[model samples]
Every structure is written in C-alpha cells, then in structure tokens.
Target chain A: MITTELFVKMTIDRWNGSIANVNKHLNALTDEQLQKEIAPGKNRGTYLLGHLIAVHDDMLKLLDMREKLYPELSEPFIQYADKVVEPTPTASDLRKMWEKQNGWLQEKFAKMKPEEWFEKHTAVSEEDFMKEPYRNKLNIIITRTSHLQYHSGQIVLLN
Target chain B: MITTELFVKMTIDRWNGSIANVNKHLNALTDEQLQKEIAPGKNRGTYLLGHLIAVHDDMLKLLDMREKLYPELSEPFIQYADKVVEPTPTASDLRKMWEKQNGWLQEKFAKMKPEEWFEKHTAVSEEDFMKEPYRNKLNIIITRTSHLQYHSGQIVLLN
Candidate 1:
C-alpha cells in the first residue's frame, strides 16, 4: 500500500496542478475578457475569480491554518449567489488577490506535516470527528482542488 | 496519519461525487442545448461528454482493469481533438453508453481492495514504478475525478 506520506504528497500535487490551471485561464484572458459572463445571465469570470478567492480564504478558516486573507470577499462573491453588485474589485485586482491567496496557502501547506493533514478541521466537532476521521484537513484540499478545477473550467469558457 | 484504506475510500468518494455532478449537468440539459459551444469556438457540451466517455473508457485500459468498451469512440472524441465530423453517436445513445460504462466501473471498483489501488498501473514500467510507487491505479482515479469536474464546469455553461 502507498504510505500516508505519498497520499498527502499526491493530493498536494493535484492541488498545485489545479492552481496552475486556474492561473493559466485567468492570465490568458484580458480583464475585458474576464468581464464577460460564463453563460447567459450566469456568473461571469470576474465573479468566479472572486468566488474562488473567497472559498480559498474560507479554506484557511476551515482548516484552522490561519486567519482569512480576504474575508470581505465572502459576501458578494458567495452567500448572495452571483447577484453581483458594484464596489467589487476589477478583474485585474482579483487576479492579484488570487495570486496572493495561493502564495499564502502554499507557504502554510508546505510547512504542515502529512500527519497533521489527517486531523479534523475546525468545522467538525471532536466527537463527530472521532467517529468520522476521514473529514480531515487534507480532504478539504481534495475538495478545493476539484472545486478550483470546476471554476477553472468555467473560467476557460470566458475565453 | 490516516490509513491507506481511508485514503482510497475518500478518493473514491470524490470520484463518485464528480460523476454525480456530471450526470446532473447532463440530465439537466436538452440534447440540443448540449450542442452549443462552451465558448464562442471552444469545445461544446456534446464533445465534452464524448471526450469524457472516451477518456474513462481508456482509464480501464490504462489501469489494466479491463478492456475498453467503446474503442470506436477514440477516433472522433480522442484522436481528432473535437473537430467533430459526421456520424457521431446521438446524445441519447451516448447517455445510455455513459450509464453502461459507469455501471461496469462501479461493479469493478467495488470489488477492488485498497491495496490493489496502490499497485502500479499498466503505463509505468516495473522499474520506474519501483522507484516512484505513487504512479498507481488510485492516482488515475484522482486525476480523472478532477478531469470530470473540469468538463462538468464547462457543461454547466450550456444552461
């Protein structure tokens, strides 16, 4: 069987791969391109980018890794569900924030031991976690990795 | 650290989740809606569905788990890169084919032990696998899960 260490390493690799893909989609598009909707009246690239930033920021809180870097993004990008209003950052600004968020996650994740990833996240109660240990910190990364790729797919649609 | 068993189980759960998401997108759209381009000139939902079917069919071969059920799909969906020509399967037929494929996989995968997932896939040479044991069957599932999510994201654009 594969070691727990290898499992952790592979999960991180997939996370990084999704991040690279998301960046590629974001970088290839101009800010103007990003302003277009992914579909008719659906979430646009701008909202998707901001949404990802908010979700990743929440990831930090969920795992108890650190304080959120952009907690303000949660309201408009999430919670409200794409009835996006003004006073949000431009696509250009969101791109930079995406980079900043990923950079912070990479640093924090790099320092964490593989064993630490198996521990339950803040969302799960201690008693519940004892019963369902698979709901751990690394599982958050697994879900987020898929989640990022999902948005990345839509981001490419903005192209 | 989490056991290898738990890691395998979580990976499978994510795989199942992505499959369910893809099915949701497929079932929601009319066959006509799926024919529209994901973007102005990029892959359409139809091609994405076919491409995913082809890729998953190949996954069975890659893992040496079973023979491909739809070898014919490789040409239009895989080798040609979605410059689709005439005589492709209807969306109804493709949907049924997808159901058949997933049913077979569910049965096969259900029987597989966690340790079997750690064994090297067919693509890796034995020598290489010895040096890099992480190139295993489970890794393929992990990748294909993200891949399905990526397409599912784009498929939602058809709505």
Candidate 2:
C-alpha cells in the first residue's frame, strides 16, 4: 500500500525538478528579455515567475501547510484578460521567493502523517467560489503539481 | 534523494485511492440512473465511464509499462463538448475498472528500473507523444491521482 508519506515525498521531488528547470531557464535571461512581450496579452518571463510564487502560496493554504515567505504579493487577485496575472518582480527577487516557497512546502510535506492522506475537507466559502470538487490533502498535492506543469507549458510557449 | 522506487510506490498508492473512491461512487447508482443525462447536451453516466476507461487506456501507453490485456484501442479519444461539462459514471463499474487499472499500473511501475526513469522515448506522433514537462512517466505518476480526482468532480457535478 502507498502511504501518505510516500506520496508527499514523490510530490516534493517532482516539484523540485520542475522548479529547478524553470529557475534555470529564468536565470538564463536578461531583464530586458524577461520584460519583452513573448506572448502579448498573456505574460512575460518575470510575470510568470511571480505567478508561480503565487501558486505556491495558494498551495500552502489549500493543503493547510505552512505558508512561505513572499513579499511582493500584497494585492488581491485580478483577472486580467484571460489570465489572473501578477505584476513583474525582479528576477533575483522572484528566484529568492520561489526557493523559500518550495523549501517550506517541502518541509511540511516531509513531516505529514500517512494516515491523513484521505481526510476530506471543504473551504469556508462556496457561494461565490468556483465550484469544482471536494478534495483532501492528497488531492491538493497532486492538483498543485498539475497546475504548475500546465502553467509551465504556458511559460515555455511564451518563450 | 528520492529514488525511482519510492516514486513508483507513491504513484501506485495514488491509483489505489482514486480507484476506491470512483468505484464506491459508481456502485451506488442504478442502471437507469447510469443512462440518465446528468447534465445538458447528450452526456450521460455511461459516457463518463467510457471516457475514463478510454483515457486510462491512453495513460497506459503514456506510462509505457507493457501491453494492455485488451486489444489496442482504435476508437477516437473520449472527448466532450465544452470540455468542463459532463455526466457521471455508475458506481459499480467505476470501482471495478478503477481497481483493475490501478493494479496493472502498480505492477508495471514496480518492475521498472531506476535508470529507466529518465530514459528518452518517442510516441506515435507529436500530437500523441507524452514527454517531459507535459506528458511523461513522471507526469503520468504524479498527475494520475489528481487527474482521476478532477474527473471525479466532473462525475459529481453530473449528479
């Protein structure tokens, strides 16, 4: 039987691979290149980094894990065009924030108990919330990874 | 430090949870309810089951473990209108099929070697190909649980 501990570890490792790849790609670019409209009306490089950091923040809340340190996310989410875009953060700042985010999330997953994998929970708001599925902690881990990879494709396309 | 063996175990466990939930849900429904349209358009419970089974068949190929017990599928992909809209599956067959797929996938993952995890491979075509950053073995493992759970939402919404 696959335990929650095993599942969390796999998730953390996969995220490690993904973040490493994205950060490597980001660090290769210059500031001007990061700002260039690779995909107009969508997002540039720096914006994508900020978005990733935002995603990790949400993952923490959803999974009931400890939140990571990110100083740039002070505003509420705004749907800009088809994307819920965040403003650009400096490349260096984004990298530091993401590293911190990933670190804290990893630590949380590492300590989680295997027995709680299937416990179901609902969010406080549903009236105005986008109704999807009722999920547990395990679901949260997998969903965030899927979401990241899907957006990573968008970033790759933007490049 | 996460080895391939550990990832494989995690992948298999996720499949177990998914299959259990889906099958449990499916077994509680009536055959009449199975045929009834859970939503607008032409979608019904049967369509959702068929789609999931079809995708499992596709996912089997994506994992590239071994040949399926059934013959190669020649039918078109199980798709839906509007993407998000769909009907639910019956509770019984959903569980049965869930167990069947999970068992098979786990066995395959266990037999695979650590070195083979990062191997490069090709698919029938670019459109059909499953590769890194999108569709790959690593992804198939990580996303399998979430993918099933996401569709389970579609199944629930159909109710």
Candidate 3:
C-alpha cells in the first residue's frame, strides 16, 4: 500500500508540472500562429487559450469552498448549447490572469495542513460525507489536471 | 485567449464537483449491490476499482515527475487483455490505494506554488516539452477519472 505522503507528493508534482508546460507551449506561439485556426470546425489557438483561462477562473470558486461561478455551464460544449463557457479571456489577458491565479494557488498550497489533505467536504448537496471520508484530496488534483489535458489535446488535434 | 489561471481553476472545480458526486454514488452501494457485474462480459466493481487504482499508481510518475514505475506493466493491461479491454488493478486493492493516495494529496495542494505550477520537465527523452508539457499530467487525470466514473456509472446501474 502506498503511503498518503507518497500519493500527495505525486499528485502535486504532476499537477504543477503540467501547469508550467501550458505556459511554455503558449510562449512558443507567434501572434500570427496563435491567431490561426487549425481547422474549419475547431477553436483557434487563441480561443483554446482563452477558454482555459475561463475554466480556471470558474474553478477557483470550488477551491474557495464557494458555489460554482457559473452553475449554468454544463457538459458537451456543443455549438447548439448556446452555452456561455464563461467569457473568453484573450490570450494576453489570459497570460496575466493565469500567472495571477496560479500565484494564489501557490499560497493556498503552502498554507495547507497535512490533515486537510484527507479532510473531506461534499461539493454536492447530494453527497454523504460520513460514508465518503476515505476519498482524498488527490482526487481534486487528478480531476483538474486531467480535464485540462483533455481539452489541450482537443486544441492540439485542431492545430 | 483564456488565461491559464482561469483554465486551471475551472478544470479543478469541475473535477471536485464530479468527484463529490461520485463519492455519493459509491456510498450508496451495498455489498450485494457492488458484487453484481453490470457488464457480465467485462469487469464489474471488483475489477473496475482495482483497475483504476493500478492505472492511477502508474500515472504517478508523471504527477511526481519521476520515471515510470512498473515499466513491465506494458502499454495497456496486457495480462487481462483477452478478457478485458485493458489491464486494470484489482478493485478492492485499488479502492484501498485510492483512499490512501487521495489522503496524501490534500497536503500536496497546501504546498503548491504558482510559479512552480508552470515549472516544465520532459517526461521522456523524445517527448517535446514545448508542445506537450500538459500531456502527461492531463492524460493521467482524464483517463483515470473517466475510467472510474464510467464504471461507477455502471455500478450505479446495478442498483
């Protein structure tokens, strides 16, 4: 059985590692390259970048233990949904925002208590904490990082 | 362009919410309920949980920025490839591992740094850091969580 300390270390290592990579990828893009859409139906590089920024801002609510910023945004970003996937922040704007938000996250991490890693809170009204305390914090790391990667992949395929 | 901050936050929130829901769903299960295989031709709860844990453990290399563990495990779950779509960790073991790993993760968040979030490392010699910084981290979360949720949904169906 892996110890909780080992798991937590792994989770953060992976989560932060990816965050750094996204910046690296963005820095490599020329403005013109950023502006071009890879395919007819796909989001442009700028759009993807914007979308990611929007995603992080929205998600911060959960970290704050507040309600979701946009409860209306739902699954399947289908064109027909007419759903606002949060306001699309521009790339330049996104970069600044990305840096800022990650800054907050860093502070949050540094201040965390070891016991809090296992501290379980129900994000949904339907959740029962008594029966779910075993669920750990890495759960958040895995979910968030994976979600980013999935969309990033979509962006890559489009390019 | 979406800022990295907002993108990361949104991803984080969505995952937290989903996991909260998943915990609720899992807590609702009874022993008898867990035993019944939703897809008789494939893995049921016993196998699914184990599969998830095993896959997750493997993904830890990327999360922790270490070399891959269990390199001998193969590209997919080859041992059970004939009976299963992929090789998976056993369900009981996986759950135990998940609980332990997740517990550790809570502490990880506390130590996370905004600047560190953007720290980039190459996963493999040939892997392009410029293009795929987020690939390893994102892929780990997306694949494992989706795998769990898909099966958890199946587990729910059994009831």
Candidate 4:
C-alpha cells in the first residue's frame, strides 16, 4: 500500500535530487560563462538563473508556504523575455537569492506533515480544490520539481 | 480525496504538456540548427534529441510496457558523452525513432488501468517492491516525465 509518509518522502527526495542535478551544472560555471547564451539566439545563463529565482519566489505564494520574497524579480526575469531589457541581476546576486530562497523552502518543507500536503494551497479555492482533488499542495511540489529540472537541463549547457 | 485515477490523469497531462513544450521549440528550428551547440562546450541539439529518443526507448522495458525498439541508440546517445563518437544517426532517422517510440508508448499508456500503474514493474522484484511501495511503476512515469521536460528545455535552446 502507498502510505502518505512514503509518498511525501519520495516526493521530497525527487525534489531535492532534481535541484541537486541543476546545482551540479550551475556550480561548474564561472561568472563570465553565465553571460553566454545557452545556444545561439537563446536565453543567456544569467537570465535563466534569474528566471529560476523569480519562479521559485512566486512558488512561495502559489504553494501557500509564504509571501513573495522577491516580487521585484517578476518584471525583469519572469515578465520580459531574455535580453529584451537591460539592467538585469548579476549572476552573483541571483545566486544569492537562489540559495536564500531555496534554503527557506527546504526548511518549510521539513515542517510540513505528510497529510497536510493533500490540503489545498492558496492558489486554489476550497471548493474548487474539493471538486478537483488532484490539484493539491503535493501536486504543486511535483510540478515545480519538474520545472526546476527543466531549467537545470538548460543551465547545464552553459558548461 | 486524491484518488489513483486523478493521479494518473495528472501525470499523463504533465507528460503530454512537456512534450508539447519541447515540440513548440523544436518545430521552430531548421535542420541546420540541430547541429548547433546548446552552449559553447555542451551537447548539440541533435545529441539531446537522440538522447531523448534513446531514453524513451529504454522506458519501454523500464516500465514493462513493451520491448526495446531501438537498442542501437544506447551506444551513441546514452553510453557515450556528447561529440565523443562519430557516425551518429542522422537528424531525420532519430526524429522518426522518437516519434514512433513515443507513439507506441502513448498507446501502451492509454491501455493501462489506473491501478496497474501502482504495481511493480519488471525492474523491481515483488519482495523489494512490497517493502518500498512508492517505487511503483507510476514513479517511473513521474520521473521520466520530468526527464523529458528537462531535456526538452535544453533542446529548446536550439531555437
């Protein structure tokens, strides 16, 4: 039988594993390398980094874990396409934000009980969530875990 | 409540969505673009595509849905690092393999009853599977869905 505790553990393991896979690539790059395009006519490493940070920041509210920590990030990183605007965050700054935000998320995840993960997050209403029971807090984690890995695959190309 | 049917549907939706996301970027690229490096010292678009095909091919056995269709893909795409080998399959051949393998997998997926996904696949024994129930066949689908999106994100950089 699939117990709630086992499901939570597996999900968290996958989440951390995906993040670690991305970090493996990110840690290998230098400041100069982060500015280069992932491919010709594609987003730069720095832009992707900032974009990831912004998305994770938004996840805080979306998952009902916390309020937005970096609301300013949405405009440049999430709103505009890569290289569409000037004055983006430096790689170092974005790295700092990534670490801080992920650290907080990790702590928050640890505090959550397995049963609580089935409850609706802030993004959904209690009624809608009841109707569509699959769209639970755990689903958010699964989707975002994939999202992180997706960007990580792109970031790895910078090496 | 989070029913098994709901979980299966959500997983399938994310699987298809990730494929769609990759296709959007892939459809925009020219044949020549597939040869370009995702970054200065990274895999080319062709390599990632072939790699994805090889992985999905492996998934047939991993999920116990079918037998291997392209065993040869493992040599160049999975075993060797990028650009380490010559005489790789052409872009056309790999693309065909990709489509065919995915089409077969989709059919297999469609035939599965929701509960079947919770059973142990060929890769795991009944004894161990019982001990770690979370390592069900469904978990493979979940992980590989993320795997597809991860590389799809990289392949998109070819645009």
Best by lDDT: 1
Clashing pairs in 4: A38-B38
For residues B38-97, what per-residue lDDT tens digits would candidate 4 score against the true structure?
767788889999988888888788888677898888999999998888989887777788
The TM-score leader among the candidates is 1
Against the true structure, candidate 3 reaches a TM-score of: 0.45
TM-score of 4: 0.91
The TM-score ranking, best first, is: 1, 4, 2, 3
**Distance from true location, Cα of A9 in model 2, Å:** 3.4
* lDDT (Cα, tens digit) per residue for candidate 1, span B1-159: 478889998899999999988888889999888877877778877788889999999999988988999999999998886665667888888888999999999999999998999999999999999899889999999999999998888888788
What is the C-alpha lDDT profile of model 2 across B1-159, one tens digit per residue?
233454444455566666676666666667566665544453456666656676777766665665654332214225444234333344465546656766776677667775454343335454554322233455565655555654553354333
Question: Which window of 10 residues has the lowest lDDT sum in candidate 3 chain B?
Answer: B1-10
TM-score of the first chain of model 3: 0.72
Candidate 4: regions farther than 4 A off: A84-86
List the DockQ of the predictions in order: 0.70, 0.06, 0.05, 0.62
Better of 2 and 3 by DockQ: 2
State how far residue B72 of model 4 sits from its true place (Å). 1.6
Ten-residue region with minimum lDDT total, candidate 1 chain B: B81-90
lDDT string, candidate 3, A1-159, tens digits? 123443455556666766775666667676666666534434566665555555655555544444533333223132222124545444566567567767877677667764565554345332554544434454555666665654453343222
Report how far off residue B21 is in candidate 4 (Å): 1.8
Lowest summed lDDT window (length 10), candidate 3 chain A: A74-83
TM-score of predicted model 1?
0.97
Taking the tens digit of each residue's C-alpha lDDT, what string does model 3 give over B1-159?
Answer: 123333334334454554565557656766456545543354465554444445655655656643433444343343454244445444444456557755555455335543344444235443464454444343344445544444454444445
TM, every model: 0.97, 0.47, 0.45, 0.91
Stronger candidate by DockQ (2 vs 4):
4
